[model samples]
Target: MKKKVFCVLIYLQFCFIFPKTSFPGFRAWLSPYRMALGGSGYLSFSPLTNRNNPASLKSKKTFYSGLIRYPSSIMGQGLAITLPKKERVVGLAVQHLSYGTFDGYDSESISTEKYSSSDTWINFYSSKRSTWDDLKYGFAISWFKSSLAQNQINAIVFSLGLQLYLKSIDANLGISLNNHGKVFSNSSNSSGEMPKETVISSSKKLKYLPMKIFFDGIFNSRYKLDNINFGGEAKINNDLEFVWGTSLNKISQNTRQSFWKSFFAASGIGLAYNINSIKIFYSSFFLGTGTLYNGVSFEINVI
Candidate 1:
């Protein structure tokens, strides 16, 4: 479909341009911005994965998510909101992506523009249940604008979910406990100095499985050290309406790299289109590094 939307618009312009000076030393987890905030495969996007598994939040009565992103040549917009909570089940999301007049001169000597950049992401989710047939366990917190500066990155996640049925077969499982507030903060560079190195990153999500066919994994570490990540994904169908997939991500041997992301292996392909109100979610059928992503998430149900 137009080359999976031009390989995720060239993967957001080759990794959303980063440089506020200090692009040296810190090869702990080769992060292409944590694999572009991950999500190229594995279950091919599950209601926007936080993994407290609500079974794709069950048919949705109201869930709004929109995006106009091209994080690389700069032009962005994002939004999200999923709700239905009294026993507590809510999701609020915000994404502003970024903007900047990109320094202008390739550096022959800039006269007016000093430099500037941006990053954003905000997410919140809640779930509570002790006795409710829907059986769920939830936790998610995100505020990551911290690539190094606009520092907002604070994360706390813990989730456990399960759903099972027999008649038509429906299964779900989710496990979490990621970034648990090991939040690192130490930024000051609007000219206040004091920040030689205070980088922080953490990860965990060994698996999230929703059956009919799909699985996901993550465990790239860094907070206290000792890391490992081995991924997985699988999907196949042709009747309930054709869809295919494959995925694999590996990083072990103390998993780490961060001079601009390393570690290999990638796979893709899982597209869905249900015409009417129009629905289109895509994939680039195996994209490892140059580009991949053309996410068109749509949902609107009023009942």
Candidate 2:
């Protein structure tokens, strides 16, 4: 157990100390559960969390999930399906983001036709337990595409992840390297780079309370810590749970506001309900600019 822990720590240190060039796209949160957790879900077991950590694909049953975000000009949706095969699990997911139509203008400011822009991702992933039952490892390959009017770009990304289950502490620790790959563009206006991130996360179920807590750190290039998020899920009943989360970046951005307002800025709250083999989730997020967006998603278990 100690050796496993050490290995995870070493890997995290290496990733942080040796940063790589990172671009600026493909970092959007694809899962409602993750967004509701203030962008922290690297240690979660839900199939929707597969984009954050492929090692979370360890499950005995198959799962299918769909998500939609709205109330904003920029809309997004995602779909994920996971299948268990013998001792390993394989999954596929797709996420799409659409920017509202924009009016086109020429160099002389003449009005032209309206155009829309969008980004899409398709991911294939797999995971399995290591020699030790407590350790899990996984990898993922993603194809990404972005379009803006007549310009288009494509990229392929690769990710690797590791998760360790500490039975004694009833906690899970995970590390992941995501979006590490090259990009190609059909237009000269596009940059041939994609964003990369390193994440460290932990989740623990309280022994004395019917709750679980999560903490996650995200790092970008130049060894800079991009964000730190904290989230909690409390069981309200056998079939329902309350979820809430906040991030340091949000709080920092609203320091001039009221204490509570600043604290809740960029925060999120939601509820999850379970009925038979289906689970439903609803979430609302408070943007730093005071705008609010709601998301809904559902998952079904297929034996």
Candidate 3:
């Protein structure tokens, strides 16, 4: 079966990716939904949500989303395809962030073209509904690769997530355990364990208002209290929405920084259009300064 083959692939990855050491500031890539919602994605409706909470793969459609950074070469793209039974989903996602190319010199102070320092992630996800309470269970395997000069570092991480929806309260809760694995290096002297983290998030739809509020709390084993983010989305109509939120994670003590920088307030607007069985969405967010992160996605409800 396809599931058996995928399981074998995951087993092979664990064998090659788990030999262990320690490093801080591991790759914390964010999806567009996370960026637009000020870093809250545990209960987002985008295809990329699988990266944040695999239990969010409850969609019964063929979904795709892609994001590109402004004035940069960074990109994140993902796709989700639902099974015929409509109770399970499988997905794949890829993200690449480049820190630009640098000059390679032989200690002669002479330019030798440019080599890029980049990080990439290739992830696979699957989720299914449990027999009780309609709850969802999800799993993900991530392949992390970092390229710096001639050295390439690779690692694999496993994640488990669960999602529950309370219709009486109009609220959804998602919990995830992430980054469980070890690192491997092609060069000598640099192999370590990845930073493990726990994420808890919830979203509540207000009864009186056309809005939904989201909250997320993350705990890192190596770096306690990593961040707390919350935001709200106000629906103006069935197709247009406004979003705003702030991140309290990386605030600075400097008083001279812009207010946006001081609190990391990220705001954005989104529009969606539905045509028969297909729906398209577009969204963009402020990333401080003049840079903006943009995202677009489409979904097809298959018959």
Worst 10 residues of 2 by lDDT: 16-25
Where model 2 places Cα greater than 4 Å from the true spot, the runs are 1-25, 45-51, 58-63
Give a tens-digit lDDT track for model 2, residues 65-138.
55545443456677788888888998888777765466778999998897766778888988999989999999
Give per-residue CA lDDT, model 3, range 1-303, as digits (tens).
343344334323223222121432132233555556766756664445433777776456465555545333444455555542466777666666554455566787786766655667777778888998648888888888877677787888888889898888979899988778657555635665576778898989999999899888878766467778788888877656676665653342223358764344245555666677775666666533324567776667777
lDDT of 1 by residue, 1-303 (tens): 354344345434333321121211111111111122233222222334332243223333445554433424433344555676666556666655444433334456645443444545466765555476544555556664534323333323233333332223343344444433433453553322111211111112223532234444444332232222222333233211233333333232113443223332233334445555444444332233433333445545545
- Candidate 3, which ten residues in sequence have the lowest lDDT sum? 16-25
Q: Which ten residues in a row have the lowest lDDT in candidate 1?
A: 24-33
**In model 3, which residue pairs have backbone atoms overlapping below 3 Å?**
21-192
TM-score of each: 0.27, 0.86, 0.77
Best by TM-score: 2
Each model's lDDT comes to 0.37, 0.73, 0.63
How far residue 127's Cα lies from its native spot in candidate 2, in Å, is 0.6
> Could you give the C-alpha RMSD of every candidate to the true structure, in order shown?
19.1, 9.8, 9.4
Model 3 local distance difference test score: 0.63
Ranking of candidates on TM-score, top first: 2, 3, 1
